[model samples]
Target: MSAGDYPQVGQGWAFPPHWVRPVPGPASVVTDHGEERIERSLQVLLRTLTGSRVMRLGFGSGVDRYVFEPRTPDACYRLADDVRRALLLGEPRVIVDSVEAVAAEDADDRVDVVIAYRIDRHRRPNSLVVPFYLAGAR
Candidate 1:
């Protein structure tokens, strides 16, 4: 089946559930399919976005390096655009509509990223928001 046909109703092998409380054990196992795949994909995307891309093997290819900046609002906006590009380049099944990043009101070191996109075969637009912190920025 094509990527567009992912999470096929009971067709694809089940993937582990994305979330688990405290710690994951045998009882934490959960079957995932259909739309669940989208959620999982988003989780993967987030991980990739938060990590730095390494040329060598074992290192994740991500946009985290771009996430750090001058801490200006305009910088955040550029970061969002760079994130959108990164996601599109990384995931073929995703058609990105927009990526918006706004500085957190309560924290100067944090920015909230809102991503809007649609899957290849899915009609509805999906959105996810992630807050990123400038770890070493002062």
Candidate 2:
């Protein structure tokens, strides 16, 4: 989704100016750490990653918001499985990497304020399995 369409992901607020947000579903099954908890963890991560200038945040508006992420690659498949379970009111940024990829095209790669809940370790395998795997492509 375009940056202007999503306010939570790329709004002119707490987020970095260059941190473009991704639009995707939330985590599931393997990501047992409630979505709120996941967001909280990511918020902490955003505050901790001292090298990135942009951070992708998955924070939703309210309780109805199904924004979450998997901390490990092994959990991404399961996270995808939960896509049906989570009800997205609007498109939410998928992960911090997406923002990086999109921003890279514009010549901005200083993501020192990322808010990713976790990274999927098996992303390479999924990228190969999935036909249009643009999630981790550089």
For candidate 2, lDDT tens digit of each residue in 10-112?
3223322233334676432322132333343344332332233354334222211112321234333333332312213222333323211111233222111
Each candidate's TM vs. the true structure? Answer: 0.63, 0.18
Q: 39, model 2: CA deviation in Å?
A: 0.8
Cα-based lDDT for every prediction: 0.64, 0.27
The 10-residue segment of model 2 with minimum total lDDT is 125-134
| lDDT by residue (tens digit), candidate 1, 1-138 | 334455443333344434444555444444455555665666566566333445533233254675556677677877787677667666666778888988888886888888887765556777888787764257
The TM-score leader among the candidates is: 1
Q: Which stretches of candidate 2 lie over 4 Å from their true place?
A: 1-33, 49-97, 100-138
